[model samples]
Target: MAQGENGSIHENTGERSPAGQEAAQDTSLAPRRRKPWFLLVALVLVAAIVVLIARKPKDTQSSATAGPQIATIKAATAHLGDIGYYVDALGTVTPVATVNLYSQVNGTVTDVHYTEGQMVHRGDPLIDIDPRPYEAQLEEAEGTLQHDRSVLAQAEMDLARYEKAVTLQAIAQQTYDDQKLAVEQYRGTVRNDIGQVQAAQVQLSYCHLTSPINGRIGLRLIDRGNTVFSGASNPLVIITQLQPVTVVFDVAEDNLGQVRDQILHRKALPVDAFDRSQETKLASGKLLTLDNQIDTSTGTVRFRAQFDNNDLTLYPNQFVNARLLVKTLKNAVLVPSAAVQRNGTQAFVYVVTGNTVKIQAVTELTTEGDVSAVTGIDAGTVVPVTGFDKLQSGSTVTIQSMQAFDSGQQRLERTQDKSGSTL
Candidate 1:
């Protein structure tokens, strides 16, 4: 230690003055500045390592599932079952018997016996067309009939007397013959009078209108006090048989042979009718009959089905869709229709064996809804339905149900979204 001239403390150097001290100080500060930069570089490297560690599991999982190395797909199994073959066509609801009822007698409508939209039975009175006139006519006919009957009795008595007298020769032969002829003439006249009386009775009965069948009656055209005539242009009311109705539909010519064979064999083919949207079943019925000839314009044939519409689910002239079950492939190889893939002229399916898939060629026999009957594949064969775009023969796969696959995909997307937000 040395004392300065003004008694200030001073650090002793061996051979450097204040300028040399400043140079030494500068050299010592250089190492300190360089150490901070080295620490910064080390911190950057540590951050990079931490990030890699955090993302390691995610990368492993994503790599395992994201690519086509092991495709996740929806799958199903082929099994032995019965699949229906159906023919679908638009149909119309029709009533078995519809009648536009009109008055049969020329008279005023004195009383209406039925309300609009009424249910009627056979022989139920529907209207009274001035029955007072009918009563008079019936009375006249009865009187005439009684009088003719009396005349016929008298003629028969006279004929007996003429026969007896001719046999005994009590009168001239010519005179007896004339009497016999006159009696015969009177008997014939009586018979004709009786016929006329009956005709009048029938005409009188026509004044009272009655239902001829059991059915539902539509709107009434003739009201009380309205006059109506026989064979009028417009009907008084409409009646339709509803309890046992029918549906008529058209079937394509392609299916005519099978349907005709079934009909010939007297097999009752079932038919189901649906609404316009085909989302609801309206009625069920059996095949009634088919048209005798095909319609050349549409290459189709008409079919009629009968339904016991106890519930009245169908109406006349209403449109519907019909499904006819043609046949069933019993104990056949059945698979999901979605599993069948087409490549140009070839149909194939992805048959899953263990963790890999192999393309199996198949022939689709028929499809009903979501199920199909196919050939060239045995029962209980596992097959893949979805994730086919990235698949090929001998490709590895992870079997999953449609729900599971969708859930996994959702989770992966969520993970990716989280990662992006963090960045």
Candidate 2:
């Protein structure tokens, strides 16, 4: 046992041992060593945090100084003009009249008078059936008629003689009565014979087929030398009137009121027909009529237009894009259709003032081809027609070309001034 100043015991090397003193000294030194390490680590962590915090503002400032962005766009100037607002619809060209000519008599086809696709006038003979049989029948009917008439005349003469003889009592009364009956019978026979003659003549006329209307004939369904019967299933030929054609189309029912007004006013609304691509004008016509009823399933109404196709520009069964000139709006603010943008139900246009753009709400009245009529913006206002994706309110824009806007405005003003002076 060793006694220490703190009155503790040590079992090893039993002298007043130095172990406790050394352990006490070590324990005091351990805290001093750990304090520097902890302070160094803490100082390093604090310095890193301070450095990160100090750099944040400079990074943000550097980003802020990168400069404002600008977008390039194409712009067009709105102009006042006479914009023809039209109702567009799909249509089909049809002939005014189509006639399928059929043989009306049982006879061999004797002649094809018209060529295929030949234009013919009314009463122009198109086909001829063998007339020999019909002619013979007519002759037979005429002979029977002549024979009955002669017998009737003879019986009437005999009846007159018998009546005179009965009065003189030179002949039996029965014979006179018989003679009167014979005369009446012969007259009835003669009337029947006359009917037969007329019927035969009608059949004979049918053997020679003529065009019922002025038209272009289609292909010959039956060739010459082919036997054609009355009421045959196939027609001898088809004739379609082509000089004046018609177009039938369907229009949205919503526009029915305006169309009916035009009709009631007796306004000859013009209808222009174009090819399927709607690029070329095929023909010009007048709106003929509107159907009696609307088609419930399609929400549309059918309309007919008549075209004087003197140049044969319209062909039957051809598909066309029809534009009915419902009305014309004068002094309308028209712009390129591309300039308009829609956000939900709101339509807007971006008008460029100097280098910046501002939003202008517009009501799109009508769109015709590449141009649109809009309200809420004045004519001659410059609006961007393209590159709208990069645009926002107050966005800076570099115009690729300003010539269109400038020139258009100038031209429009000059025209209006000239028109006003002329008026």
Candidate 3:
């Protein structure tokens, strides 16, 4: 029985040793098998990298598809014209002749022949003063003159008789001499009475107040039956000549040389007068005269322009704006007023070179209407009018539409429009 048990134990030990060896082999083999899992993790990481690389190209492609923002430009060119240099000033329109009607004699206003605001001619009666008292005084003086004339006639006859007596020695020398002296005294009295009568008659004729000039009359200050005196403070009416009006204005002393040159050259300094709004021209005239002396206080010289105001648009004492044409430049390069940009004292414009924009400096000569006369730019030079604010020197500009640019050309083409027509 002991031998049988030993055999069994040996067998068990042998089996257990084999199983342990197999377990050790399996443990070693399991690590070897996990190497594939590590490789799978590495493969997954590689694939993620590949996906990232592929997405980068798509993002880059999308970014490449977008374009840069662009701005529009208006290209224009310059032209030549007769550019006028004008000096603008404020002024007043006054009548060539202004008069205030007043009474010459003291009397009641019996009649006003002219209506208020009526035009009157020279020597036209404006007012009539009461002449009854003056007429009575004249009549009294005339009667005294008649009586004196009769006395003088009788004395003259006596003088004649005395002269004859003296020559013939029929009368005493003293008596003839006395008769001649009496006749001379009577003649002197008659002359004095006649002078008084003539003076009274002259005074009676002064009852009528006449207009001194051809003009339009203002409101009447005194009505009929209103007493007026020669020494009254205010006039009965004010009259202003309207046919020829004068525009008075002041010019700066700095412009005196140019004005003098214009006059010396016999160039008609065209002057235009506008109303208070400075919109419509009331009348056009030539420079008539410049004051002899400059005003020291204001440092300006006064000037006058005369206009035939037959239309009556210019009223006396009306405030006006005057434009004095100083000089004209022939074949001057002019650009639209909108194209010129001012920076401090400098003027500049944007010029288009190919597709790039460049800022060009310019000097202004004069401005007329909507155009500015400049010196730096030449004809056929493309200048940008709009979208200049977004531009810098050497910036690329894309013209958005030719039609939009053509509108500016249309403005130049439409100069003959009815609204722009002027006399």
| Clash count for each candidate, listed in order shown | 0, 0, 0
lDDT of each: 0.80, 0.86, 0.82
Leading candidate by TM-score = 2
Expressed as tens digits, the lDDT of each residue in 1-423 for candidate 2 is 235633443444355458777987898998789899999999999999999999999999988998668999888889887666689999999898999888789989889899988999999988888899989999999999999899999999999999999999999999999999998899899999999999999999999999999989887687889998888898889999998999999999999998889889999998878899987677778999989998999999999999988788899999999989888777889888888899999999999999999999999988776778899999879999877889999999999975342222343345446433210
Arranged by TM-score with the best first, the candidates are 2, 1, 3
Which of candidates 1 and 3 reaches a greater TM-score? 1
* lDDT, residue 202, model 1: 80
Tell me the spans in candidate 2 whose CA falls farther than 4 Å from its real position. 1-61, 151-189, 403-423
Give the alpha carbon lDDT tens digit for every residue of 1-423 in model 3.
Answer: 688899889887777777788998998899899899999999999999999999999998888886444668775677766666888888989789888766778989899899989999999988888999999999999999899889989988988898898899989999988888888888899899989998998888888778889999898688888988877788889999998889999999989999999899887787878778866667778899899999999999999998888788888888999989887777777787778888899999888888888889999877755677887889767777778768888888887643222222233234325223321
State the TM-score for model 2: 0.75
TM-score for each of the candidates? 0.75, 0.75, 0.71
Q: lDDT of candidate 1?
A: 0.80
Worst 10 residues of 3 by lDDT: 403-412
Best-performing candidate as measured by lDDT = 2
Error of 2 at 170 (Å): 12
Per-residue error for 9 in candidate 2, Å, reads 47
